[model samples]
Target: MLKKSPVSRLENLWDDSEAVGMSEPEKLLYRSNLLGSDKRVTNYGGGNTSAKVVERDPLTGDEVEVLWVKGSGGDIGTIRMDGFATLYMDKLEALKGLYRGPEHEDEMVGYLPHCTFNLNTRAASIDTPLHAFVPRRHVDHVHPDAIIAIAASANSKELTQEIFGDEIGWLPWKRPGYELGLWLEKFCRKNPEAKGVVLESHGLFTWADEAKVCYETTLRIINRAIAWFEEKTADTAAFGGEKHPSLPPEERRRIAAALMPAIRGMISEDQHKVGHFDDQNAVLEFVGSHQMEALAALGTSCPDHFLRTKIRPLVVDFDPASPDIADTLDRLRGMVESYRVDYAAYYDRCRHDDSPAMRDPNAVVYLVPGVGMITFAKDKPTARISGEFYVNAINVMRGASAVSEYRGLPEQEAFDIEYWLLEEAKLQRMPAPKSLAGRVAIVTGGAGGIGSATAERYLREGACVVLADIDAEALSATRENLAGRFGPDVVRAVEVNVTSEEAVAAAYADMAVEFGGVDIVVSNAGIASSAPVEDTTLELWNRNMSILSTGYFLVAREAFRMLKAQGIGGSMVFVASKNGLAASPGASAYCTAKASEIHLARCLALEGAPEGIRVNVVNPDAVLRGSRIWQGDWLDQRASTYGTDKEGLEEMYRQRSLLKRSVLPEDIAEACYFFAADTSAKSTGNIINVDAGNVQAFTR
Candidate 1:
């Protein structure tokens, strides 16, 4: 059980019952998971752990020691057994002989693959040598916030000595590689009694022969720092006290919704970007503080934090006392331009001859005073994770600045890590982005078959999808199903009745805050009505118009507003029907409303042409499978129109099609995908008849 404390403290969570009967590698994984479960201990994918386990060699048929460490790009909190890279310990030791020195230590990475034990294909990380060369059998290298606060202080070495004395040692800042590994090996040999070491401007590394001892020692050390900081900071105000009061939660969110799209539009010149807003207490406190700007400008201290957040954040100038969002937005372009110029200058000044060419000059993290922090990246999870890393940095700043002068990594050192050749190689190795990468899409009526299918298609192509529908239960189920497949960060849902103007507008606001902005709009929300012209009551006609025509119009109007605000151009795929192009008996109301939808698309296409917003139509007919409309009176009406019962209606429709095939929701989704994708870039105002070759619905 974790002990309750007045000030939050890292809990020692080792359980003897949980450890019983576990193998050595299993115990290492367990320890890693326990440590990583708390963000205070390590941010996502920010740490690595290892155990040297003796195993039977497949080739030699004899026992040999192997290093099982968290592989490159694996998160210890969620890693599986296979997520570890297994290498022969003797081969790793032999690498000491091949070491050319600190300057050439990068070559050591190339030799690691040669030492893969049991032919494990998991790639070893740069930190691999650090763990492999440690004299202790089990090692935990983590970035607990309290420990990092001490490590990132200007007087880090002194503080380390003052706090723990000889119980823990301290090391000068050195980039993690073969040289650092050798240094660690030397430190352990010189001070075998020390349980751990604080790496200046980096993080903590603790070790012991037993996995349980190593785990306990790591927690004990971090908890000590946490306790020490709590006592020392009891009377001190954090971050030089607050200079700006925080905006109310709802008000801050409203501001973020207005600003994110504008900022996203400017920074997305290279690629489409997704945004994440964090107004958590830590973020609000840091952004509202007097020292926030100075501390943020100094950049992050840890290599992991620096890489994700860039050398520093671009702090937006805004005041809650005299709020003027309009003025701030007007000045945003100039501010962004300045940040880009400064980043480029930094790149130019720090480039080694062998350094990769400059990457995106745009800042990843943006600090908004009195509001909170916003981060944008190639995708949603990255944006969210980047924000989490900055939060860790904030905790470090609060502690270090309160007790000792906070220190950021020197710019030159930051550049070295950011542009390291190995880092560039990792970037090059990434899979090519999918066609819809970074695109955010809203699918109205998203719980229905066609709408859900369209959202799935977009998700498969790497787009973040927002599902909008009035059916709360169905909407939640659809959102959960997609989120499970595509990750929660890339999928969200909002309860919206597109016919309601207020509801439609609010959904757009939610989208802006959740995903930065919108890129594609699938105006698919609709209802079907069938009545002969002589028998069509005013109520029936108006209901059809309300959902089929007015609803599409409402959603498209909101899409136009957001697309224009972002000024990045977007696609609007309106799911009309074949009846729009071909008159159908006994369905006068539905036909007229759909015809109006088609014409509306044409008008919007012409208006949006100059802005590069593309508008198109997909006319699907007789889509019977998994359709909610078909489950209602529309099914009986359609069957009666064809002179058939419900069971034979599908076959009759299939036989009536020129190709003798039935249409499916997935089929309509394909056309929507085309319209939403770049494949339809030059073909605005066009309509595709997906009725299996209907002569009456021919576009020509």
Candidate 2:
């Protein structure tokens, strides 16, 4: 059993007058720090925090005590008082004796009266009992990224013992809430003097009488772990020649502030903000030369941290002067997809519940080769702290692995932590509103099959849609077909040449006025021009570019201005072509224009990111149904080029794709809806191929 020391810092801190009668302002500050520290320690909302206070009883003559644990769905970092769920301490303590096993959880819940469960408030923290079990005045629990790095190692216990020398107690990972609290209760009973405890594959729990001491102790323990690991695995020249980038501090600061509000909104608390980077030459050099595949498999430092830092770092292949931002972003998107697949596999192996899982990568870490690691945060302060913690975790994990292979938690265990009831409740508490509901969307070239299908899909998804085409008769026919299915208010018709700026602008303005404000703009209005490069006239080239490229720009710009003013994040989809991926004979103008639209969407994505705007391109290869450009002479030309009849040429186009089936315009529309909806929150600057896997363009 761990023995208690005569001078326990926690005891002293709690007994101090400053801690006992802290000012409201000071308490708020302490609360903010405690929440921020916990958020940093885990991925997303992986941990919980609480403050105990005495309240006057209305009927009784004495004061009633309650523990205000962070409510479910509320992130500790930005959580406010309302974000907490107040529970009677006495009632919580009684719950312990009623449940003997995991199976009894439901029974125990049923025993509580409706009054005992506060539906008006956010769901109670899952760890409410855990915090209540601890007799400390204040408690802080986190899956500290540093500790997990060590725990995930094969000889984690040995390494931890060597590093901390028995100062920290290690607890095996257990399902949180009642079960873990029971285990912790037993551990604390035996080791009364232990200053803090580390849960394997979970996080750290530290407490003291004073908020500051509690907060600092958590940091100290992490630092001690880092220092010990650094001493053992210090690489002298591994990171040499790496220097920080020459970005202005002001620019970094502004970006940090702009991001803070959103992050703060998620966590519900504010703390001092600062930014730091592993911009030193040595660190950059080391990261650049490191084996990325091996390093990424190390897993996240802590699960809660996932909400802020994501599962894996974005690896940048050492190019500081790349003019093509789109290409670089493509590479990143590929890496993100790989990470998502890995995450899905991990979830499938571990998940036991029916709850919907989040697909968004909560946080992103930059592993810039030849540049040191940089962790982005909602604010500068959190970013700097996160960077330090991340660096330490990396060093420790690498050192531990050097001695023996590192092993992460079992899939089920990670799932349990990630989908713990407390955290799940948080997700349920504040149901995020659909920001784009009841808005209008307009697709250009709606007379075409793809355009009409896309417009119909948008109407089905609750958006009032206007289908525009250059042919008035065709536009009217499409409106008649869709209006009966989607209802009269859901579909409208317009006829205009998308190539003419004046005509396109006038249409957009009228649509905005008619529909209130456009939320989605699908720039699908385009014409195909095919001729040998030498024979392609300048007039043909200009005509294609004018409609396909410049037209897209004009429509998207108008939508952006409208969305910004409406204070809503809007989505835009540009219909480019598979030819945008590569050059092809007799389609030089068409290919160039399509490529230009792709680039334009990429730029829009970046500019709109801050304002919650999303822009993506759909590259459809050979969508032939109802295409005006695929008729008559155009069809004959394409047929001749393929050495086949019109029917055979169409079959060849469809069969060339990996799936060997003709992709319907509706399929492309489905892909568009994904980008247009809340499902793709983190997806921006992405180009999805609706070509049935024909063109496997390399995304960064």
Candidate 3:
């Protein structure tokens, strides 16, 4: 069950009952979770909390003061005890003597590991020194939207003086590091009674000797800001008031669906990127605001916001007043290229000598004046997080601009942090992406044995998959199973019958909106019909053709449309049967439809070759294990035709093959994966027979 906020004033969710008998570090964890719970308090991974505790030193057997702070890249909201880096406060204090001023501060990070308490494996974040240097035993540093609104104001210092009057102090912006830590230490020493300090254009930092007091102090300070903004903006216009009306919700999604794939294609030329589309109220309000272009041009205020979202978003050329999606598509390529060129210029102008080479220049956030926002990134979660961060920035802008002029970080300063040697190292340390990291796949008959297996294979390799199946219940189950393992962000389910043109088209369009565009298409939907040619009714023949042949064509046609639109080469794997090549007795309808599937794939391969779309086939024979088709009358007929009971049918097919091995769904899945992956980059219009060496199914 979702926890309800206890108070209306900015979510005071702390319950005394929940904090009983907790250790200092445990209290710190609890406090951190509370502050990080609401986005209004802090976005994901945006804040840090610390507590100093007395602990017996592993080496000296004497009590020592230790600072436990959230570790690098860890989210406070979901952080565990192991996620904190435990360091000796004495060691951190002793390092002040070694500090060679601001210029040499980057070297301080190298000594952090030396201070590791009890040899904890968690790496200390850059903010560690800031926590250690503070005189208070507990400190809460968070980027609350309400407080950031005050911090990001042009007259921020004056506003700070008016709001909390010295109870909470204000400091000019400084890049967070060893130097800032010392600066904060000096500030605390001078203002002994000050409860907290707001870092200009950054966030709030509150501290108290008691952990509970510290948590409440942070909440109270944020609530004050919220109250101030509410009272002040009650009569004022936000973001210079709305300049453009928001498109209707469905219309907004339709536009987003149309634009995301095109944007994804342009940006994903070098490395594929997954996408996320958000049209939440905050997003729509900001995008439709009069000052959106002006403020967005100034860029985000918070460093975390600026990092997740780029310095600025790409304002898509869309006007809800007179919407034309086609015109927007035509102009999108130039706009994207322009953004790249401008980003390159920014990098070239601000880069230090040791800066890493310019990274992907594509804009992470795209704002449509009418239809909310789109974000594309190396993966789905990152894209979604980028959008979330932008929304936070919008909230900051909304409140800040209503009362005072909002300010962004200076360009050179932003560049310094973006290319900071420490940050660059962190980026470099990230593990290599999986092979299908940013690819999106659509699997027809995705709830079936072979289809589900193939979808899992693609998902394991890091591709976002849309499971399209006619059976809603099975699709939901399959999706839940896959989503449980790969995460909900990477798996989606659509109830679709491949035989319906409209359903197939709608599914592809939905897939486009969900994960940007398609990279892989697996056509595995089928029906197995059994009858001698003389006894085959037209209904039986048409049923087989409708599902096996026509369904494959419909799916491929939609896949081709999207593939060409994305301009990113894709892979299509058709799961045919050995009967496509070698006729089977008493199953002429199924065999003929299977042949049509194979031939349809060949034709598509020929047509799609120039577009770099590789069409391939994976054929299997007597794959009775977990096959939905094999559970019906077709199985009985096949068994009767072979003069064997159902129990012995598989043994007959295994012995009949050149290799006496029974085929399973996983065997076919492996073949589909090969064709869908880069391993088969140079091959197309090819068929792999997974029928345990069926000589008759072999290619001529």
What TM-score, over all chains together, does every model reach? 0.98, 0.49, 0.97
**Worst 10 contiguous positions by lDDT, candidate 3:** 1-10
Write model 2 residue lDDT over 320-434, tens digit each, in one string. 4332334544454465466557667766776776645754433335565433565544333345446654554454345446445656445555556666554565557654433
Question: Could you tell which candidate, 2 or 3, scores higher by TM-score?
Answer: 3
Q: Assess the local accuracy of residue 301 in candidate 3 as a C-alpha lDDT between 0 and 100.
A: 88
Q: What lDDT, from 0 to 1, does candidate 1 have?
A: 0.93
Q: Candidate 1 residues 1-700, lDDT tens each?
A: 1122344877778899999999999999999888888887888899899999999999889999999999999998888899999999999999989988888999999999999999999999999999998888999999988989999999999999989999899999999888999999999999999988999989999999999999999888998998999899999988988899998888998999999999999988779999999998889899999899999889999999988989899999888899999999999999999999999999999999999999999999999999999999999999999998999999999999999999999999999999999999999999999999999999998999999999999999999999999999999999999999888899999999888999999999999999999999999988887777999999999988999999999998988888888899999988999999999999999999999999999999999989889999999999999878888799998888878999999899888899999999999999999999988888899998888878999878
Better-scoring candidate (lDDT), 1 or 2: 1
Rank candidates by lDDT, best first: 1, 3, 2
Segments of candidate 2 deviating more than 4 angstroms: 1-46, 103-120, 209-213, 233-287, 307-406, 417-429, 437-700
Q: Best TM-score goes to which candidate?
A: 1
Question: What C-alpha lDDT values do all the predictions have?
Answer: 0.93, 0.63, 0.91
Error of 3 at 597 (Å): 0.8
**TM-score ranking from best to worst?**
1, 3, 2
Q: Which sections of candidate 1 miss by over 4 Å?
A: 1-7
How many clashes does each candidate structure show, in the order listed?
A: 0, 33, 0
